[model samples]
Target chain A: MNKYILSKKLYRNELATFYSFLIGFLIALAVGSLILFIQEKNPFDVFSLMLKLSIGSVNSLSNSLNKAIPLILAGLGISIINSVKLWNIGAEGQIFMGAIALNFVYINTSINNSQIYILLLLVSGFLGGAFCIFFPAITKVLFGVNEIITTLLTNYIVFGLTIYLINGAWKDPASLNFPAAAYVSESVYLPTVLGKLSSGFLICILFTLIAYYIKDKSVFGYEMRIAGGSELTAIYAGISAKQKAFFAMLIGGGFAGLAGAIELLSQTHRVSTGISQGFGYTAIIVAAITGMRPIGIFLVGCLFGALTIGGSVIQTIGVSSYIAEIIQATTLFGALVAQFFFSYEILKKDEND
Target chain B: MIDVQLMGLLNATLQAATLLFIAALGELITEKSGILNLGVEGMISVGAVSGFITAINTESLFLAVIVGVLSASAFSSIHAFVTVVLKQDQTVSGLILTILGLSLSSLIGKPYVGKKLEVKLESLIDIAEPSNIFQVLLSQNLIFYIAILLMIFTAYILKKTMFGRRIEAIGEDLKSADSMGLKIAKTQFIATCVGGAFAGLSGVYLTLSYVPYWTDGMTSGRGWIALALVIFGGWKPYRTAFGALLFGFLEALGPRLQTYGFEMSPYIVKITPYIITILVLVFLTIIKNGNTGAPKNIGIPFFRENR
Candidate 1:
């Protein structure tokens, strides 16, 4: 009889981690297939159809790329703070705050030029998102409040505030009670790369490079890593962990805010409660899957972008669109589970330690 | 001058608080066992959808509640495996469970949208007779009474029972408890399952007794609110119940204030409860240390030295 034992790996293996990620995604797809089968549709055809809709054609690919822009930016934002051991769950609220800022400028100003107006709106968005997390970061450092709960609570507040503005104060008289702010002027719209793709996609790539440089090469990143790795060590070395936390969170919030601004200026053309489309929450999963690496965030962000577009595609094929969410969530869960295998091994009985 | 209408509002507050208290009390126990399960919202969504689907088919509330508890517990067992057995990070694992729970619930609940259950449990109050303050207080559904009993029972067990002491010991110092020969993993796993069950019950109550229909994302942020209440209560079961009631009164206050003909946006009114929760948390943090009333080893996964 053959015997097998599971034991801990002596060292971390990158190859194992990579394989586990693929296997995790495969498992998630299998689960998703079961959901499709339950709905009496062919899972293979649906998957292929999803692929076609998201990346198989120029038009659909452009739409998917547009969606990936915000996700990539938001994922990058989450990655920054996550590296610092601070979970900034307020990205959703920050995105909304950014939209609010963008709309404030759009409504209150007549900067109808393409070049200057877009730049101002983008800056305001960054500032708006940064302001949202400023209080939580300061409170976390000063009062020792858990940023998790505070950030989450802030999301609900922003959700309610957004709804209020859309339904009341910011409701465009031209929208005719549709509960949406007025669309931005045509010149304010983001320029297209191709026919339908927005310039926001290029900005996403640029931000990814910038985030990579900040995370890997910069002094602030070095200090953040040391502080996140060990507060005691950081304190002993005279690093102000509090300051790093504050700045890291601010940058994180700013990236997500930028996503919100791009979403408004490029795709939606107006502010609404659904501008985020839960990207803030989904970005967490993307950041985690990528191990908080900037480039990994971009690729995974696009995958999720495809998943979401596929979800809407499934809706037209008689399967519930939420199947996309199931797959997205399951993939993350499976990845976490697969991580266990990379770190440890299963052993048969009577195997010597 | 408080009128009968105001008494009715307070009465509604009690009912709302009952659901929060039930979930918070269960979470209090889980935290006492040193596991922080942030997937309370996800568990409730699954429980609510499963319970409503079962009730619609069986026309039996008891069976539906059982199904709710079982499915939610079953779902949380995945969390138990990840956090307890694998010794993974609790926050990430809990968040994953929440995403899965919400997605799965929405997918399954897609069919049941806009469909009403046949056996909805209305208020326990009989409307045939004239109402008074006492009647208004007692008019809540069966779950309200059960929540009160559960609170007292949980408080007693945690304070007096040997099992509770062992779990509390585990929460405070897992290494010491393990050295003392206590089964840390088993106790924490059971506590998590029980917590998941209670969250499920809260969902069933919401669907069966309160809303009487399944709605996607209907649990909303209530599970998160329950998590906040557990902390606001300082980890004491009875105190947590009080916190839940206070939160409920604050939530109930929003709609009541609108009745006075104020020009406030209803959406702004909806945000008051969340804002108040934040204020209370900030106040508590200022008055006491972050670790005050919290288990020392909460959120850390425990690993045994050897098999």
Candidate 2:
């Protein structure tokens, strides 16, 4: 009996990546259209309206950018961890830790100085994220524990703690009994930039560049590539693969933490359970769809930012905001399938042939 | 008085453990076949919503459970195809399946939110005395009794059946299994799909017997916990069932503590399962190989080289 077989291509197909993105995008759009049709709305009209809401006006653009800021930073974080093949799904928890740390510094300190406050917040946020991930990272390195479930479990605990803080200990006396932390001092709020945009956008860009440099060019990056690609090869090269894994997770966590801090300082002045809006989770998709590249993550973050802003926009047309989630998820599935065809081709032949 | 309270806690544990036990046992099958499907959370959600919608429309518990299992299996089939047939990364595929399941379920479930169920599975017996230990033990929804039977049957099959040995062989040494003429892909696919069906049933138990209402994202990470329980239970059916009960007891303890006027925040109590899981991992690591019970090649995609 003879059958068609799948054979892996010898060389990488550069065009495969481009085709994958296109296919994934098309699939996402198709899903969105189907959902819209079910809702009895013209898919094209809603799509155009969503674009307008996300990027049509300065106000909308600013909102979109604000939404994208955390996503970009968090995506970078996910990219860092992905490079080392460490599945740390705890970025959401790290973001909360960062916010908690930033708030701790802001409220506990007597220093009302804006410059010092911002500087301290950023540092504390990074440390907070790094600290939160240290447990899983160390456990993985030393004990061979799987970071995936541990990190995922840690997320619920962090979120639970966040809720407890907002409702009980950290409740803002001035919030009029609302379950939210007190707003940051006026001086500590992020300064405005171009037409309603926060300076946080610029910081995100800066971090993106920094991440690119560290991931693509730095010695640490070289070591990480070796460690991630093959542990034996890295060990033979005299590089400590375990150390690299630990540091990768640490840096990744820090990036997510910083994202949390920026989101709080720039957009939401007070901490609440809804502060994240699942940016940590969306960032994972952004990182994956972009192949975990820094610049690509930024672009994907922008698209997701648009989706986030547009999700609420479509609600006016009676569509559930969950459409964005569906589209995002579908895109990932399509992309993964597309990635399969990149290196292998299936040949069909008669079984008797 | 204390006996009554203890009995209530035990009763709650049975209900909670039954759902977790169903999911954990399914995952055990999937893992034993060397495929790690991490999308249990998403599959459970799909099952919950689908079963709920079915119940709302048909008012038939059996139909709802069937729909729930089928929907979850259909959702998980994507993972099975990608990981088994395509030989893609199991972890990433599992995650994408999860995200897809969640979004798709929420999309379909949008209309059913807050809708009261037309019918739900009823307990097999009614206890005249709420504090009767025997009555409390016996009087539970059909699913709970079914779960116990499933647990025993699964244990028996795994320990005594040729099919179970084949699954174990494929998981432990795929190459040997393939050389031995075992259908590796088919076995793994069937295992993962069956695992998904159990997870789906877990969801049915959650919505119909437990909450008896339709809500978005109702499973709420119980699927993830069940995955961890697969490890805590040493990948054995009986041990896993015991772990489920342990988890169930912890889950029940949280609410019971609240009822008892414990000053601790409910949020802290809610996080106990996760913390316990972490501690369990650490303890396992300290005592032995942390992942000792995991099937070898659990996440590796099998590819036959022409050699």
* lDDT of every predicted structure (CA atoms): 0.85, 0.86
Candidate 1 regions with alpha-carbon error over 4 angstroms: A1-7, A347-353, B125-132
lDDT of 1 by residue, B1-307 (tens): 4566677677768877987888888889999999999899899888899999999999998899999988988888888888887777788878778878988998888889999788986667665332576777667778888888999999999989999999899999999998999988899999999999999989899899877888878987888889988888999998898899899888878888867667677889899998898888888888987765899999998865435
Cα lDDT for residue B196, candidate 1? 93
DockQ of 2: 0.71
Q: Write the per-residue lDDT of candidate 1 for residues A22-49, one digit (tens) a residue.
A: 8779989999998888788899999999
lDDT of 2 by residue, A4-64 (tens): 7776767878767667777988888997898889888899988898999999999999888
Judged by DockQ cut-offs, the docking class of candidate 1 is: medium
> In model 2, what is the error at residue A136, expressed in angstroms?
1.5
Residue pairs clashing, model 2: none
State which docking tier applies to candidate 2: medium
